[model samples]
Target chain A: MSSDVAVQIDRVGKRYGRHWALRDCTLSLPAGRIIALVGANGAGKTTLLHLAIGLMPPTEGSVSLLGTPLKPGRPQTLSQVGFVAQDHPLYRGFTVAEMLRYCRKTNTRFDQAGAEGRLRDLGIPLNRRTGRLSGGQQAQVALTLALAKQPRLLVLDEPVASLDPLARREFMKTLIAAVAETDVTVLLSSHVVTELERICDHMVLLRGGRVRLAGDIDDLLAGHRVLTGPRVDDAALDGLVTATHGERNSHLLVRQPATAPTHPRWEAHPVNLEELVLAYLEGQD
Target chain B: MLWVTWRQHRAALLTGLFLLAAVTVPTLVSGFAMHEEYRAAGIAACLTDPEARAGCAQLLDQFTAHYGQWGNRMIWVTFLPALIGAFVGAPLLAREFENGTWRFAFTQGVSRTRWLLTQLTVVGAAAAVLALACSVLFTWWRGPLDAMSSPMRTAAFTVSPGLVALTLFALALGLFAGVLLRRTVIAMGLTLAVYLTVRITLEETLRPHYLSPLVRTDAQKAADALPPTAWVVDEGLITTAGNRLSDGDERKILQQVYDGDTVREGGAALERYLAEHGLRHYTEYHPADRYPIMLIIEIGLYLGLAFALFAAAAYLVRRRTS
Candidate 1:
């Protein structure tokens, strides 16, 4: 509805034949913030990212990027959003220099010099064929190309999913450096959450084609806490997300403000990002 | 987009050029020699001068014997369109889907339709140019032989300007299959199969019937009843009762008439017997003057098919998600 909202998806649904990949999905990703989209495999993460970037039309409802309605072949909408698909596909036969030139030709606003400078700094040779590059270098090149477009919203689907730990770290370093240099809103999806906790300010967790939780990282962490007390019925706790019990004690992950009054016999501890994500993922029956 | 298409497909385009050159160089060398021999033998003058008919027959026969097989071998050239469809057109989009480069290419600032249309134009234009060059070269090479036989026949027809449209049809079919099938080898296989089926059907079952054949029936078989360059659909004897004899019946009667007799005496006796029986000779043929109309019809057919295939491919590309 507003320019400050980089991507707005309203009750969007996608169906492949008889199966629904995503349903009733609604989100307003704010501009100029790094938002991490976390979901397990087949959790509709890729489907949602594709809809936001206009890779395909949603079967029902609408998606808008930068206040413009998303359409698959509209150049105006396409120009404002950059996407790096899973595996960072590139023309295997093209030299890195040719790949850069190709990107420059296709985009109206391309930072050719900036991209070359980035590649040079990273020690990626201009004349080397992309197919010959290491997986890490290819990812960097893909990122550089997307950044060169100077898009308002950048959507990445599983950017580092296939990389080794060292390559993953290097790829993230480039991504973080670029984010620091630009005002672009990023919505990157990953099945793994540990690496994203430090860089992402906002988070959206998806489960079974639905959004399980979405909020600012700090508020989400602060709003949910784990409580341990003597064994009690599930109904005894308020705002319970998930509960596990032993004969002598019980632990409950609950959603409430940090300053909420607690029972005298129970102990409250802060939940880490991984624990919070897993609890929600596992809690979904 | 133009640069992108060119850079991506330069390997295939260059390979097409190299193959064209490989075929053209040999055809050109032999074509020049054949034309020289045609001139030196005076076959062109023989074709027109009725007074020289007697000597011309021997000369034409000698010239045909020298180069006739070479012209027939040119039938293989018709396979060029099939190869183009399979190798160039099939891989055009199938490679994108197979390699997952469509994700990268489609998400660029240019719209997907613009990207697809631009690539099609570039590659389609290249195929057209190649087809045109092949047409011009082969048409020139086949000129001496066309003066002997009819250009309406398969050997010459396959290499005419109609080939340009046929090549485009093959290419469009390949592109459509590439998008529909999404696997390079499978699309190629389908393109080749469909192209051959269409071509063979058109040539065998449909071409001769493009227009009705002219039939001539007479009491005696006249020397000029049919032109030398006419495409003879059928020829046989018509019985006194007005029933046309099948080729098999004619062959059996001729064999019975010639049994155990001298060739010269047998011919005279056969004519007398045919007269006594009141059987007439009939010849069905399409005249050489119909060459242009036949070519136009064939070209129109292929061009119309090409247009339909292209439209289908465009629709599929537009509707495709992911």
Candidate 2:
């Protein structure tokens, strides 16, 4: 409900028949910030994105964008929010330029010049049809279309999975630059946490249709550590928050400050987003 | 906005041209040349102009009777458009959704509803144009045949541009199939089934009743045109101006045509046709105005189906994830 809140998810859940796809999951995405959703396969990442974009109604809860509930075909809500699902659905016969032209014609907030300029910078041929492109190129065109919508909240299911490492890096670089320059709030779901580490300040980790951890990236990583010892017991490290435990010299993750006595026994190091996500997922198990 | 729909269906347009050629060539070859003949009285004979020895054959006359043969002409008219539609409509939006281009359209500023409706508009318009072209061509081409093949109504609306409703009907079916199956091959098959099912049902059983009492008759004028006076008295019917042929009377009309007489359908419908056209006691009669009635019903059914299927497809595409 905050004025800066671009996405507000209130206890949303999605189920296909009795099978739970997402459950009791909630997160409020703030404006002008990048939030990354990282999860393994079947972790409910795509479900959360679909719900946020109002493509499907949640079975139990609500998802809203820009202070209004997201409704399919509601002009105002869609005007401020854009979504890109996996596989980059596009009209095959239309060239990249033609697709951009259609968006410009259809959307009130579409930025024709901006989209064209972005595609130009990315070395994507404006006249080439997306169907003829490689998997990576098609993904770029899809991203370019979504970005050009000039939305307040951009929810992408998996924006760069098809890209080669180089194309992926370039896409991320371009996206980060855009996010840095604009007040757009982005929520991108991916399994590759490393690609998001540099730009994302907020993170949400989903597992088994539930949120295992969600908060500011800096704060979550700061208190967490990969504890190592000659023979440290998991029960011995119960007092501190153990994000995950390994078999040998368990990599204990803690959110609490260590006492002077326990300081020498634990090795406190800054956990990167990838390690932090793995730690939390392991801990949940 | 509707023009946007046209840009999307350029492929359908190209495919329609091929269909037009396929339909037109046969009609031209049969109509412009070739005399229809049969063995009769130990010699060759023509169905219509048996007495004529040469110049134009009976086949050419029947072909020349383009306007005269209402049902047969209609068959020709609707077939080409249907063929065109079968080729293009199955792929119009099915290819897009099957290949997953809907993702681009849905995720961008355009709502799924807008994008889908626009596509429908384009395809529907193309159907309308194709139907109109066939109707106009067939109607114009059949000037000579009207007297013998169709005499009750001045107009015979079998498959006109309105029949393009059939194509729109097919397009809607294909699009819905695309959403359900998510593959062009399966979608095309679904569309074919729907087109055949609806078209067959409409054209066959249900359609005869919409306007009530579909009538067809041979173009013959003579004392022989009258069935036995005893047969009429037996059916509790009086002799009107024209001979009536019912949907159940295909064989009767063929017999009456061989006897060189006019055939109508159902005593009541023929009486009405005779009264409406003021063609009392005519040997050959086919009224033309009844054609519009058929076209109207066809158009209504097709549009209704297309809109409904399109709505369903939009719902599926907007909600389902890959």
Q: Interface RMSD, all models, one decimal each?
A: 0.9, 2.7
Name the regions of candidate 2 deviating beyond 4 angstroms: A1-3, A230-248, A255-270, A283-285, B1-4, B17-88, B150-162, B208-322
lDDT of 1 by residue, B50-103 (tens): 778777787888888888888888888788899989998998988988888888
* lDDT winner: 1
Fnat per candidate, as a fraction, reads 0.75, 0.46
- Compared with the true structure, what per-residue lDDT tens digits does model 2 show for residues B1-322? 3545666767668777676777677666554432221122211323244345344344445444543343354565545444544555556556666675655555555666767667766666776677667666665444344433432231344534555566666666766777777777776676667677777777655554555442333332233343211111111111355444344554443454445444545344544544454444322221244445656776787789778887787777666665
Compose the digit string of candidate 1's lDDT tens values, residues A175-232: 9998886789999999768888978989998888988899889999999999988988
Docking verdict class for candidate 2: acceptable
Summed backbone clashes in each candidate are 0, 33
**Model 1, TM vs. native:** 0.94
Best by TM-score: 1
TM-score for every candidate vs. truth? Answer: 0.94, 0.75
Model 2 gets an lDDT of 0.65
